[model samples]
Target chain A: MTKRVFKAAFVSSLPVLMGYSAMGMAAGILLAGTVKLKFLPFWAFLSSGINISGALQFIMVNWTEALLPLTQVALLTFCLNVRYAMYGFSLIEKFRPLPWLKRGYLIWSLTDETYALEVDSAARTPAGENQLDFCLGVAFLDHLYWLIGVTAGAVIGAALPFDSRGIDFAMTALFLVVLTDQCQSKINRLSAAVGIISAICGRVFFSTSNMLIPAMVMMGAVFIIFRGKFERKPEQKEGEE
Target chain B: MSRETYFLCMTLTAGVVTIALRAFPFLMFSGNRPVPPVIRYIGKVLPPAAIAMLIVYCYCSAYQDKSFASGGFGLPELAASVLVVALQFWKRNPLLSIISGTILYMVIVQNFV
Candidate 1:
């Protein structure tokens, strides 16, 4: 039974393995180039192991270089990751009966891909399967893949002597990929417009370093003010099952 | 604080904050209680907007460069983004899109500019 669960979870996570490892390598290489610290791969391992976030892994190199204020770090981390909170809402019932340790690990590893797979597996789980074990297996495998990717990138980056100019565009390309997917839905298109406008306004009004918080605030305000407009009608079943 | 200490602090801070955010909903509305309508509303709508915001943030960095004019007038970014969108739309394969786009940007910037 455990073998079957692992097989299902592993098959489901292959795509994430490809994505995370590739993206993680880029982020890891970025860190190696930007930060001159010795034992860089060790840091990469630790940070990637704990955070499990793509954007933050990329953004942290900048913060580390500047030694940005801890307050700013806290706030940016919050803003970047707040979406995970929303992801938990859909899984609350599925995860309700899990023991504290397993439940805690599940929440900790609830990345976008892992969450999607967990939810997918849950929906497809046949009667009498150990759903909890399947999810845990998926989370653990995804986490390991990410760790290996980042660590490998760091090791390779440290050893390479070639100029890696413009590799940072990988991060930009990632965001664009996510945005393109989001824009496929009509409602998301409007929300995206709100975000883009809010960000542009923030950029124009505030200094570059200070734009994010204001943009987030503005986006939130706009979303709330037009909730009726942006929020789908009750009959819509877009929420994850 | 020492550099190592500072780095550790930053890592722990980010980790703690992320865990808190991920766990907030579960802690708040466990058991049979219904989630607030407003919270559910935000959950449904916020992802697209936030992701859009991040995309803007990514490009804004390049725009912030002091050498924007010298940086091929942002042509590399624009071209690569177009490639990514077109390829992703056609293939719907994220790895193919991202890797191709990033490599194209790298090649363009490395050779042309």
Candidate 2:
């Protein structure tokens, strides 16, 4: 049973393995190139292992180099990662019955791809097989892939003398892909527009370094003001019911 | 503080904040207490907006120094971003789209401009 769950989890995580490794390598290379640290691979391992965030991995490079204020780091991290907070809502019940350590690890490693795989696995658990075991397997493998990818990239980046110009666009492309995917929903379209507009306004009014906080504040205010429009209609709720 | 210690603190801050956010729902609603509708609404709408904002931020950083008149008139960034969005929409494969777009951007900036 354990072997079956592990196999299934491995299969499910293959795509994540590819995605995390590629993206993590990009982030790690960026870090190695940007930061003048002595132990590039060590930093890569520590950051990727602890945060396990694709976007943060990229953005943190700048933060580390600039030594941005801790308060800003905390807030920016919140803005960039608030979506993760929502992910746990759908997973609360599934993880509730887990032992504290297991559940804590699951939460710690609850990245976007891992969360999607876990939710997908929940739907298709094989008979008599433990879902938590499958989830743990997926989480462990994905985390491992991420760590290996980032560390390898750091080592390679430090050794090679290749010009990395324009490579950082990978981060931009990643955000674009995520935004493109999210824009498929009608409700999401409006929110995305609000975000784009707010970000532009923030950039215009404040410097680049100080834009995101204002953008987030504007986004929250707009959502609250237009809550009636943004919220699901009663008809849709009834249909779901 | 030294650079290493500062880096360590920053990582810890980010890690702690992220774990706290992820654990918020589990801690608050573990005992069958219903989540407030406001919280639910924010959850649903926040991701798309946050992602969009991040994309904008990315662009701002990428073009921070280059003007519209210079650096290939912002063509590389715009073209690569458009390619990424279109490929993602059509193929639904993130790895393919991101790699393709990044390569295109690198080639353009490295050789063409």
**Candidate of highest DockQ:** 2
lDDT, candidate 2, A1-241, per-residue tens: 3888898889899988888888888888888777778777998899899998988888887677667788888988887888888889889888878889999999999998999989987665667899999899999999999999999988888889898888888888888888888888899999999999999999999987788888888898888777877877732331110
Tens-place lDDT per residue, model 1, A97-118, is 8889999999998899999988
Off by over 4 Å in 1: A122-129, A234-241, B1-6, B63-65
Per-residue error at B25 for model 2, in Å? 1.1
How good is the docking of model 1, by CAPRI class? medium
> TM-score of predicted model 2?
0.92
Predictions' DockQ, in order: 0.68, 0.76
User: How much is B113 displaced in model 2, in angstroms?
Assistant: 3.1
List TM-score per model, in order. Answer: 0.90, 0.92
